[model samples]
Target: MTPHRLGIVGLGVISAAYLETLAACSTLVVTAIADLDPDRAAAVARTLPAAHPMTVAELLASDDVDTVLNLTTPAAHVEIALGAINRGKPVYGEKPLAVTLSEGRSILAAATQAGVRVGSAPDTVLGTGIQTARAAIDDGLIGRPVAASAVMVTAGHELWHPHPDFYYREGGGPLFDMGPYYITALVHLLGPIRSVTGASSRPQDHRVIRTGPRAGESIPVSVDTHVTGVLEHVNGALSTITMSFDSTATVASPIEVHGTEGTLVVGDPNTFDGPTSLRRVNDVGFHLLDPLAGYVDGARGIGLLDQIRAPRRGIARANGELALHVLDVMESLQRAASQGRRVETSTDADRPDPVPLTPRSEWLAVQH
Candidate 1:
């Protein structure tokens, strides 16, 4: 099959992961790459065979490319996406959609007006860990889901990130920076939020960089160190999301869902797939549900993030597929505030083309 020509913007470390994952698939080909740092772009291009980096304009203008992957920094997502949308090209962005809610909305608005397709990150919801959990809920294995909550507490990105400048910028707060993964998973499993209310704080005065090229640099904190939001769902289910980077502590439960019959413990949404376990106390009392062994979409999403270094051949088409579903959730939320109406979605948004997530052949982190 002829592969979809893909052009990726931004050559950050995350792009390295995408390259690794893309090598495993064979649906899309990275025709070109673009980055503000010409040298950085050239560096990534050298790793790929015969594919060199180009300017954003050059990549977009190339006749060989069909899809534009906006892997730029969070703050520039809206501008890059709008540019691609104006050209009537499908866009797949990294995450947070944009630095601010207004920018995110404008990008969505432009895409809607142009009638172009747009996708965003945090594809881990489609991972077998999450999908397995979703399947159990659908089958009433967990009973009626009553409520959900997620806690993401980190010491801050400055400790490890080479360039930790963006995370502390205006749009670089705990909620917008690291929120997509946790929140996306909730929306995928629970449905869109109804009304949101919460408080945020910039709990830190300064940060010391511990890793990367710039070590021991003091970074200023501009946004909230932690953001606590309460999500009220249409199904009468309530969810609490607490994000913090000022504290170096782990959560008792990173993610948890409560229902009439049982509870589901989910894995970190940062990865593609994982072993998710469920525990339930039905009429027969409490028992741990078997570790779901199935092929899931998120594992495949690694390919999407890495399509440049190692190119994939064709597009994956599947209902409830990882990429498309996550994209819809993010896009819907981008415009959700303005709608003043309920936004509903399902796993059937896109046809799973790459391959349907199936039960894995062996058990690893997830077990019976």
Candidate 2:
């Protein structure tokens, strides 16, 4: 099969991670890159195998690019995606799809108008981490799932990131920011949500940075700093979600799903190699598993490290592909919520439902 050619629209930190993922995605290739900052584009260009750096316009016009990897910040997502779709290229976009639900709608409408496929973010759901867990539940290892919960708390990103202003603005907050990962995982495991009710606040006066040169800079808040919501799924499963940029405290047990037979402790949905643990109410031991199944040698690294090592993980060669699927679901959920209707999603229309696997850490081709 010919590899899907991709053109990336941004050279930010997130795009760097996407570039790294291509090492293991034998089916995808980065052929072009564009950024308003020529230097940033040049830097990203140097990292690719044969990438040609150009303006977004030039890249969009290139017939060599079959898909757009819209990694631009949330603010530019709508414009770039619209451009690509108008030209009949498929898209796999970064999270939130756009800075506003309105913007997301426009992008989706454009994709629909142009008859192009659109994929959205927080692809961690498709990673072996979440997929493996889904398989287990389907296989009856955890019996029938009844409830689940997820947490995402932080001190905010104004200090460490080079440009932190966008995060504190509207369209950027705990719910929209980290919400996709939690929501995407829940939908993947329990199916689409029917509704969500929530509370929000921008109560923090200031936040501290944990890393980088401006690590101690204080960031003022404009958007909601804390958010809690209930996802009422169609399958009668419910998910409790809590997110905040108000604290420096860490959260344990990123996700937990309770079922008739046992409980599953899931890894963070933000990355793919999360460990899954199952134990019945009266069980003596926790059964540990990696959602990636036969993929990966069972190493659990948290945060951006998963992105860094995904291309090299034993069975995570498919991490980038999984991310594409995850991006699709996250985009659909936002569109569903914004459009006041549930989305019917099927990019890979013929894909099979996941089959559960017994707990094991079988390794696959690590590299090469």
Candidate 3:
């Protein structure tokens, strides 16, 4: 098989993780890389013997590139993706798809017209952790899932991220930044969301950066920092979610699903493997479940891999439809919070097919 030639846009902190994963995969090859700061791109290119630094425009137009890996920031997602799609190259991007649902729709529409595919991140669901939990639910281990609760809390990204101003910006709140993981996992396990009721708060106007060269710097907060919502799934299951940058600690499980017969403590959706546990009716304690589905020890770039292996983008597990649906859920939740009313979602997605457990060697191997 011919390897998919990859042209990466944006060489930020998150790009480092993707590069590390790409180094181990065989299905794709990094032929070119680009960043707003050409020096940064060049620095990264030096580490990959075959990849060369180029301007963003040059990377988009390169004949050698079959795909564009968009690791740009939230605000730049749509613009970069449109550039790649217009050039007839398939594009995959980091989470939120775009800052707004309308922008995400535009990106998808443009890709459709250009005859190119689009994929989005938070592929962690493809990892064994959540996938195992999904397998359990599908196997009826939980026996009719009724409700779930997801919690994610921290002091704030400013505490450790070198440049976290974006975390508090319009598209960077706790919900938009972190909700995708929890919400996506929920959708995978239960089904698409039909509506949402939300409440939100921003405790401070500014935050002080506490790490790296930007330590002690103050950044303004323009979006809600603590967001709580209830997702009413189409399957009639309910999911309560709390994503906060205001709290320093919590003893709550990252996620838990309660059903008619049992309850499951789902592992972190941000990870690839799990120590997933379950407690049946009258059980004394939660018992660990073995890895049963998804890529073993998966990493950040698996969604792109799924896209590359697909015969058509629509069938890819992390296709644009799922990302667009996720974006719509988040935007509706935020609007519900701001308007003091429950909001109905305008989009929905069929649960992507479950992944059979893939051996570590196969998942990491480049198809030749």
Candidate 4:
């Protein structure tokens, strides 16, 4: 089988992880690379024998490209995705889908009309850490999930990120930036959210960059720094979520799902694999569970690989429908925070099928 061709539209910090993961993939090849910075694109392209540096438009129009990987920032997600769809190319993008719910809808709608697939990130949820927890819940180890808690706290990305300006912009708040991982994992472990009630605050209007060449430079913060919300899942399960950039630190499990029988502590959903621990209703303490599901030694590009392979089997686990729903949950939560009322979601998505334990070697060897 011929390898699927991919055109990457951005070369940001996160692009390295995807490139590293795709480098060893036999089923996918990066054919074209583009970025606002031509030198960056050229630098990245030179590393891949099959890839050529091109303008965004040129990459989108390239005959060598079979699909477009939208790695642009949150603000550019919709533009790049829609462009790909309009050109009849499938697109797999980084998370948040778009800056606004309506923009997100437009991308999906365009993809539908163009008859192309749309996939999105936060694929971290498809890893062993979250998948193992999902397997437990499905096996009744958690006997009907009742509630969940997701917590992510930090002083701010400005402390480490070289270009942290986007982390505090319109599409870049604690809730929007980091919420996708937690909320997507919640949907995977529990189910789709029905409604949400939230409260948020922006205690600081400016953040100082503590690292990189921009060290000590202050950037304006236009979005909330602390966000807390309650998500009501369709199954009547409630999930409490806190995403904060104002806090110093936290020792809490990234996520904890409670049920009548036990509580599952899920590891960080931001990575491909993290530890998952469980403690039954009457258990003495939480015990670590070995990796029982998801792509073994998984990495960033696996979701795009999963999407590529979906045509041969079931739906893509990290698909656009799920991403759109997650975006809805997030936008709704923001609305709830600003309105001081419960905001019912207008979208829904089925829980993607659980991934059975499979090694990277096995998955990479399969023909799509």
Candidate 5:
């Protein structure tokens, strides 16, 4: 099979992981690269013999590029995606789809009109960790899920990220930056979100960098740092979510789902493989379940491969519709917080088909 040619835009921190993962996959090939900084793009190109650096405009117009990978920051997601769509190229991007739901909708609309595929991240859900939990739910092991809790807590990214300014801006925040992973996992385990009610806070106006050379420098926080919400799933399950940049620690499981017959502890949705445990009504404690679904030892670009496989199948698990729904759930949550009312979500997506356990060796051979 001829590998799908991918042109990558943006060489930020997240791009490194995608490059690493794509390097090992025979299903996709990185043929071109671009970044705002020419030097950075050249540096990335130097590492891949088949890839050459180009201006963002040049990369978008390259004949060898079949798909554009938008790894740009949240604010640039929509612009870059629109560029790719106008050029008639399929797009697979990093999460949040775009900074806002309106922008996200525009991207989808353009792609639909252009008749090209669209996919997005939080592909971690397509990994063993969350997929295994999803399998358990589908198998009736949990027996009618009732509610779920997802908690993610941290002091702030300014402490570690060298350039954390974007994190506090409109597109960035605890809710948008980290919410995709948890919410996407919930959608997989339960289903599409129907409505949301939320409350948010920004306890501090300014944050000081702790690491990096700019340590002690203050950055203004324009968006809420802490967000708590309840997402009503279409399946009638209610999921309570807490995403914070205000706290330092949390002992709660990353995610836990309760059902009539049992409780399930899902592993961190940000990771490919972790522990997924379950406890029945009569069980003394949660017991780890065997890995039952998803790509074992998976990595970031697995979603891109899924996209490559979609034409022969259908929509990839990490698809544009799912990303749009996740975005709708989040945007509604933000509005709910500001308006102090429950907001009905405008979009819905089907729970993607479960991935049967695909070991690394087998999944990698999907190139054919």
Candidate 6:
């Protein structure tokens, strides 16, 4: 098969990971690079044999590009996605699909009308960490999954990120920035959320940058710094989640799922792979489970590969519908917190088909 040409639209911190992973894959090729800063795009382009720097508009309309990789910030997600869609190109984007549920819906609606595929990230769920735990649940080791808890805590991004101002913006709070990984993993392990109830707080009005060149500068916080919520899944399972930028640290497992006869301690959802442990009701202690499913040694760009292969496989695991649903869940949670009432989700996405154990050799091999 011919390699699918990709036009990458952002040159942020996350783009490096995607570039590293895609460079080794034969099924995809970087054809164009674009960013808000021309020099950055040109510098990145100099390293790639086939990629050339282009303006965002030029890249979106370029005939050499078969697909668009929308890695711009949350605020620009809708604009970039719509630009690609209008030009009749399939698009794979970073998480939250868009900052607002309405913007997310617009992306999907445009894709449907354009007859192009839409894919979204936090594809970490498609890796061994979550998939192995998913296999355990399906094999009845945990019997019937009844509940789950996901926790993410940190002092805030300002300590490390060079441009940390976005973290406190409307689309960049703890719940929006880091929540997709946890929530998307929950959807993969459990099911789609039907409703949500939440309570949130913004403890600090301003935060001091501690790491970058702007170390002593302060950034205003416009969104919630801490968020706690309960998600009621369509299958009747419940998941409690806590996402916070105000907390320092914790010993809690990133995620834990309880079932009729056992409990599974899942690895961090943000990572591609980690340890998954299981403890039966009668067992002396938790036992580490071998990797049972998913892409081995997977990384960021694997989801885009999955999307490209969806034609032959019949489904895309890290798809736009799932991303849109995850976005809806987050938006609904925020609404529930503000209104002090349970909010039902306005969107739905079926649990994607579980990934079977797939080695790097096989997954990375060029598909004919």
Compute the lDDT of residue 136 as modeled in candidate 6. 94
TM-score of each: 0.81, 0.78, 0.98, 0.98, 0.98, 0.99
Global Cα RMSD, each model: 6.5, 6.7, 1.3, 1.0, 1.0, 0.9
Instruction: Give candidate 1's error at residue 226 in angstroms.
Output: 1.1
lDDT of 5 by residue, 1-368 (tens): 78878899999999989988888877778999999999999999999878999998999999999999999999999999999999999999999899999999999999999999899998999899999998898889889999999999999999889889999998889999999999999999999999999999999999998888899899999999999999999889999999999989899999999999999998889999878999998999999999999999999888888887888777788999999999999999999999999999999899998999998876665542
Reference-based TM-score, model 2: 0.78
Better of 1 and 5 by TM-score: 5
Cα distance off (Å), candidate 4, residue 74: 0.8
What candidate 2 gets wrong by more than 4 Å, as runs, is 1-3, 205-220, 290-368
lDDT of 4 by residue, 177-245 (tens): 999999999999999999999999999989999999999999999999899999999999999999999
Q: Write the per-residue lDDT of candidate 1 for residues 112-193, one digit (tens) a residue.
A: 7886556677656556666666677777877899999888998888888988888888667676677778877776677655
How many steric clashes does model 2 contain?
A: 8
Model 6 lDDT on a 0 to 1 scale? 0.94
Clashing pairs in 2: 120-327, 120-328, 121-327, 128-291, 128-292, 132-291, 135-356, 296-315
- lDDT measured at residue 27 in model 6 versus the true structure, 0 to 100: 77
Model 4 per-residue lDDT at 302: 80
lDDT winner: 6
Report the Cα lDDT for residue 364, model 5.
65
TM-score of 3: 0.98
Which residue window of length 10 is worst by lDDT in model 5? 359-368
Candidate 6 pairs with clashing backbones:
none
